[model samples]
Target: MSVLPLIFTSGWASGINAYAVVLLFGVFGATGLTDEVPEALQRPDVLIAAGVLFLCEAVADKIPYVDSLWDSVHTVIRPVAGAVVGALLAGQSGSVPELAAGAVGGSTALVSHLVKAGTRMAINTSPEPFSNVIMSTTEDLGVAGIITFAIFHPVGAAVVAGTLLVLGTVTALFLVSRIRAFLRRRAQRRAERRAGQAVGPPV
Candidate 1:
């Protein structure tokens, strides 16, 4: 039951459309992004922080090197978030069991982060803006679903997560394959276009 809550809550917290935001939060500090979004951006700090992070994500996602940079940073992030949240919760109840729970929580976050990074890498390989948008949207939906499950039914969330973790792995492989094919096709098309232009369209 406890494990379920951790999984579900973490899952939901991993947003799809808000992946960059969530990831940034994970990279920077978990609390800022883990809690609910602020009701108003009236506060200067909140507004500025949000803007900077979002912009960084926007620019980073587009630049190949920067995308790698984001991945490198986030590699340490997700696990920390999981660990922090777990530790906080464990503090509430001082018990050996609780300590174990915290470890589990932190580990879960790490696993989630790895899966997410894999997906982003696959998605970013394509130069098509639409593909990134679509994948991002899909990720947001997955995160939302996990959150909803945590709130409503934890048992269900665990089952779903276990299933998805397996599926996510498969999906990662599939995405990698598709992205490679797409890149290859794009390169061929670009070469053809350049060749045609050089020949003056064969008159």
Candidate 2:
């Protein structure tokens, strides 16, 4: 019954979509739906801002290259958000140091962010945009499900989320070579197209 599970799960979720994580905690905390959230996040302004940002991210995360761009921009933001959320969660119990929670959250977020960014880099190489859309939707839903579960069944949620995070990072690392090969192939194709254009018609 330690709150570590909820904190860890939230930190992991924040890495994927910090705004959604913030919005979830804020709304749920404000509504008294769950006692696990911190009062600091229950403020009206925090909830509104998080909700707006979540909307913005929802749109940006569906595009092809745009999603990658968004991820790059959030390289710092997401991890920081994760740390902040973790610190807040820890403050509720008074048994843990907020700094310690922040460190855990930040580190977990960084790992998850790398996996997400690397996967998006690979996915961007695809010609069709459908895969990007599907992946984005899947991530959003995954975050949502994890947060909701953490509310009522924190330990179970933490286990499941941690498993996925580890799996994703490992898979992304394994696919690095494949991703590099894909980029090389794409560059070659582009070069061939340019060469063809330079040579002009056979005449």
Candidate 3:
């Protein structure tokens, strides 16, 4: 029940598209991100698997241009995560209804990922060196979280993930528009102040 809330809240708040992106570049052959940890915590194989996945994500991120390359390769990665989500849902469920759930999961993830990647690309176009790195690291953790949820709690995870995706994308658009308006108003105020100075006390 507790995990259910995490799954639900994070699912919606995290954005489906971003969750998709995380899976796109990170899920393939990477076991730890989605692998279930044995409750016992005594399994050597589980430990090894966890270590390897973390190492790959960490190492890949460190190589200056590797992140870009990874992104390029993941063009297909987003869809694949969706497919996996679909398949998982279908397997756990029965008939057309179950399959539909998978499709929804996959599609939600795809949309969420698209928005997130587009936003990140726009932000990175600026010349700030550290901004991209900081963004990438944060996103990586997000990806890990999504995967963990997908693997461990499919139904609850799907509901939460889907909700988060919708909420995030919508909220992001609202925030962006608000910020632009604020900036425009600020700019106008500055212009008015400048004109007042030039007018020289209305004389």
> After aligning candidate 3 to the native by TM-score, how far in Å is the CA of 46 from where it should be?
14
- TM agreement with the true structure for every prediction: 0.57, 0.89, 0.48
Tell me the tens digit of each residue's lDDT in model 2 across 1-203. 56778878888998899999999888888888988788879888888899999999999999999999999999999999989999988888766689998988887888888889999888887899999999999999999999999999989999998999989988888778798887799999999999999999998
Candidate number achieving the greatest lDDT relative to the actual structure: 2
Clashes of each: 4, 0, 15
lDDT of residue 147 for candidate 1: 54
Model 1, residue pairs in steric clash: 12-147, 16-139, 16-140, 17-140
Better of 1 and 3 by lDDT: 1
TM-score of 3: 0.48
Candidate with more favorable, higher TM-score: 2 or 3: 2
lDDT of 3 by residue, 1-203 (tens): 22232323222323323333333323432445433222222245544554565566455543445654554554555555554544443443333353554455455545665555444544544566566667667666666666565555656656755665666678657656666787799999999999989888854
